[model samples]
Target: MLKTLTKTLLCVSLLATFPAMAAPDGDMAPSDKQLAELYWQGQESLKKSDWSGALERFRRLETSLRRTEPASADAAIYWQAYALLQAKRSTEAKATLEKLKRDYPDSRWSKEAESLMRQTQGRPNVASESSGNDDDLAEIAITGLMQAPPERALPILRKVLQGSHSIEVKKRALFVLSQLDEDAALAELGNVATTSNDAELRAEAIRMLGISGEDTAIERLRTIYAASKSSEEKRGIIQAWMIADKPDLVMQAARSETDEVLRKAAIQALGAMDASKELRQLFDSEKSLENRKSILQALGVAGDTRSLVGIAASNESEDIRIEAIEALGIADDDDSGENLVRIYQAASSPKIREAALQGMLISDDSDSMLKLYKQASSKEEKQALLRMLTLTGSDATLDLIEAELDKAGKQP
Candidate 1:
């Protein structure tokens, strides 16, 4: 069905010709061959997802047709409207399509315009005009029901989900069902997530439940994760739990999950949920370097600047300190700025100093970095600070660097 729609969009460039009409510039208009080339160029742009390019080409064609072949202008006009729609300029597309209909009522392109309008509005295409097909009728009825008052639309959509409708229809019904705030609606979504034969639909249902983020939805996800044996399925449940901010279940999975990958996924989810205190505790007890690095990454994601600073300051291993420094950079909290400068000043190894410079850049500690730059006794340290300022991309620091450059230029 989606492919059919894509083909329709791709074929919009092909058009019928009419007798010559007036040219706005009072000059010879582009021949049909020339216009056809432009049309195909627009189609090529559409194929490449270049909406702006397609819009420009179609608009040029519309202008050329308005002058040289007024009757054939509707095709270009319809395609222009279509390009606007594709560009996400819907208000303009609607107006353009309306103009196409108003200006060319009898033209075949007007029917195409109508179909495009229907598509934009999510209505069934009357242009297809296939009657007596029960499936088609049901789809149309369901579409209408979708737009009806929730009081009226809810029951029918639920029935549609339960019925043996097409997967596409079921997906649509599921979406509508998910929007309802009622317990029954959430239950159906959970049912789909847990039992749907279609993997994609099941994932989508899980995602929708996560999006719901209600207590019941979170509980259902927790239950599904506990009962599911498939790692892929459990991973999906963890992601949903992350979205729902069910940190306790995520923390439990992180600690107790037998699967290494699933455990890591749960840890990442914990980071995303900002469970920094738990991750800090886990880091202190964790023995493996790999696991400790993962904890550092989660701390970065959690952006717990105080904890990251503590890790940087106190971690005994050089590698762990470097990792903490890198994590602090990823965390990007300005609160870590002072600590980063401290790390840079006290570090003996060049690599640790380099890591501290990176952390300072990421944390946007321009003032502290510049102050250190001015106080530096070594040329190497001053040069490093200059590089750090440039790398940080802070406008204020850039201005200072520019002024320093200007002053240096005058000295020689």
Candidate 2:
């Protein structure tokens, strides 16, 4: 559903089978309070974006309320139509809306609903519309972006940005723009990243530039690291650099940075760059538990076979060891499969053993995998076995399952 046209929302679900099942005096009856509470339940469901849920609750109330008094059925019917619209059950919305206008000629909700039907062309019936809640305005704006295409949202977002949007809203708007229209939004974000007083917002703008992240942005980030008064700002810019895959800049900072904290950050950024040279250095020489752990993660992501030994080793923290074990699964090199078996053999603990099992599932070591399948216990452990069998498409396991199913089904 296009977000722009959803500047107005049109749906929820309403049905209570029992309300129409019997009246208090006869087959069906609910007091005004019960009807009001039912309506409130529908409202709650609507807010959660569970339109069908709301519709079911409202329908029961509608059915029950109709028997109590014909005069009140008007409101129930209107909301039912609204729910149908929200469910993206549009044919039903049209039907219910038609019923509303035909049966209740003077309802305010019906008239407004008719207008909604006219306006909602090209809109997916389920598109969210934020109501008159100022406190949730930024959230509404975000919701609008989530629903609206960049073309449609761009205009509304431009209006919000141009208007007196709250700082929070401005930040969210910048993010939405960056995601929706990366090239164009980068220009706007660049202005923010360069000049905004809110360094967090500036950093966010830089991060959102995605693949359009520019050399100018890189240099600006470097300059920010070199000159910013706040440590937080430098950290933010460094993160932005890492996200843009500017490993060279990160390596440069790690080699020459003077401040101990910033130097550590630079080193962390180098590890984050997921570059082979830096990953090797981290695996070989980094002495800090934290730093070595970070580097191992980089190695895992870099998928460099050289780090296979270091990742397979148990010298680092359990967390790093676990990350390294997982990394082997993704490495896809000849020795990667061997390294996983080695880790599996050497690894202890339920967790590392399980991680090793997972890694081996991706390895070509079918013999070792077959052993794990026989020994693994618990549903999750069995699931790992199934994943191994599934991904590898092992003929033996497939034939086993098929044979078992055939025996149960009595197929020849």
Candidate 3:
């Protein structure tokens, strides 16, 4: 059933296309080719078990289609929830599923969402089960060990880690091991993180080390990060640093790491940590335009509106300024609409003004758009505003569009 659903969703995505409508100010909507590229990239990420990467691509795809293609948007939503569930973020997965059901209830993806929702409810309680499997029994034992003395639990957990148990059971054992205060337990967890053959298990152990929040565990992560050659492992360590709230460590990597991917991963981690001050400093000192753009994106993720506004208003590079304007829309702060409108009005470059207009759309500032429509000086500008208003799908905007059409028809 899951395979059939996946094939159906893929067909829906492949067939999705933007309507043949010109965007305001000559800004073009993403072409069908671009959307297909995003979908294929997301599929590749999922095949590699790169859940975060898949989620990001699918989320962008969903946002691109939300206003124009409800069916495609719902399919993206289902994939987003699937990625979240695979990442063990059940709470977020459940929320995403709820959104699909609430907003796209008639969608074919809704039935797949129901199955995912059941999975998000999690495994059955161990105590009530009569015929428990190895994984279930392992969970039960781990639960009992939580109350036992550390000395007793540590030895058993160590054996479990060394045992031929399933990866799921071993993961449970590893997590329990991380909770132990003993040096022996930390060492055992570190060994798994550094030496495990299974990449997924190693990543889990690394995550558990971060969750442990022990200085020793943190030091061990640094050691492993310094020694590892795999970008995936290094990225995992960067995420672990974010979870441990070690922004300074992440900052160190962001500043010194030679790998652009790792550096960007660190920047993203800083953003997730809300290290706005650090991000601001990086943005100032960084010489690479690409890295600077990444910092801007992180700032948006961090909701640093003041910085975004400053860049949008004063950045020397037109491209950078436009990126900042788009970031403002992504930030969607209380003042974002006003700032976007101000930028739109002040921008001399058609591209910059178009970005501001798109920002307004993203921020859903219909009143501001309508105000701009009334203030527009050219027929082209008014037409663009009308098109934007139509996309908003508000009754008021629709009425305004109708009146504008009538007036235009009465003109010479």
Candidate 4:
């Protein structure tokens, strides 16, 4: 009974894949917006199971696209036929399918139409008929094994992995193997992660191991990370560690990993985990300018405005200071605007001043900005403040502009 159910599930999966097939080759023309809206209405109607409404919309779409986009018209016709089948009008559905096949023999919808034709004729779907093939049978067998006791299922799943089955079949077997709670299942998954000849399968097993959240699985992941030479594999391990909420593991990679790209990936993961203190420490001790910049960016992602404020005010390189200021803008913490105002006041370089002004603008600190404009000693500074204030379009700023205009007129 479970075997039959598994075969049925396999057939359903194949049928589901039909609608997900790629659309026709060309991009839709801009003028097709109205037609696109009509198509969306049809899809929405189909989703609601309003068969008559769906048929009406698609019928209209078919007539409209019949001339310039016969391929799209064929798609409309296919959906119209689907609506007919759902409404239990099989005779009309068959007739519509015949029209699709006869008019656009090369349509992308032809394969799906043939399947619908079998449905109308009360014959089994092609998916069910193809279930006797070796790959399909293997997948079906593995899916069925998912319902059995773990002790009985694990050995069969293991054989499926070791045998000459297709990658898809083995992936299904691995998936079932991962679902089991036994020690044997973890061992098998670890074996696949470490020894699989296929890189894709190995990555899949690694991801599954992390998701298992078992102590042994976490240890295995660390062991894999230590020995793996592939940057891609190491990056995947870092991501898995992030998923498992192991920030210390991620920070370890961020600090020690020699590959710059992988190290940045780990830093980014730490930011995502909101490891502000660790990132701050890394920033202070790190000697490489590029990695320090990366750590600052990570701090921004962690929303650690205090660290960013310190970096912005530090004697770091102008480039690093500007990066921190910009990250502060992105962080947009409550005190960011106040800190930016202070930075602008203290900065000696025109470039640093400009970056600080931009940060103020981003933080929407228009009040502090207007105050700076009032205190400006140079025409360049006032003009720069005017441009950023114009972007804000605040009434107070506009009034200030008008007042400045009057003062300039009197001076002339």
Name the top lDDT candidate: 4
Q: Name the regions of candidate 2 deviating beyond 4 angstroms.
A: 1-163, 166-191, 198-200, 208-211, 229-232, 253-274, 310-335, 343-369, 372-412
Ranking by lDDT: 4, 3, 1, 2
Clashes of 2: 20
C-alpha lDDT (0 to 100) for residue 400 of candidate 3? 93
- Candidates ranked, most accurate by TM-score first: 3, 1, 4, 2
lDDT score at residue 398, model 1, on the 0-100 scale: 79
Task: Give the TM-scores of the predictions, in the order they appear.
Answer: 0.58, 0.41, 0.69, 0.55
Cα error, candidate 1, residue 64 (Å): 44
Which model is ahead, 2 or 4, in terms of TM-score? 4
Residue 390 local lDDT, model 1: 76
User: What lDDT does candidate 4 reach at residue 4?
Assistant: 40
Worst 10 residues of 2 by lDDT: 12-21
Whose lDDT is higher: candidate 1's or candidate 3's? 3
Candidate 2 Cα lDDT to native = 0.60
**Runs off by more than 4 Å, candidate 3:** 1-132, 390-412
RMSD of each: 17.8, 18.6, 12.0, 14.3
Off by over 4 Å in 4: 1-149, 152-179, 358-379, 382-412
What would the per-residue lDDT of candidate 2 be over residues 1-412, giving only the tens digit for each residue?
Answer: 1123222122101111111111111111123333544665776676666778888887887786777766667666766666666566777877887887787787656546665466345455454555325637666757578567666777676676666766667766775675553345556666777677765556556555422356555665666567767655565566566666777777766556555465566665664455778667645765566556445545654667567566567476677677677656645566776777667666677668766665655444455676666676666766666666654556776775676578769954
Write the residue-wise lDDT of candidate 4 on 1-412 in tens digits.
1124344333223211122122333323213434655785777677567789999999988887986576668888888988888787888999999999899898878877888888789833343555348787788888898789999999889888898877778878876776677878988999999999888788767766765667788899999999999887887788677656688899899889988888888887888778998898888888889788778767876889998988888888998998798677656778888888888898889888888877766556688889999899999889999987886678889899899899989994
| CA lDDT for candidate 3 | 0.76
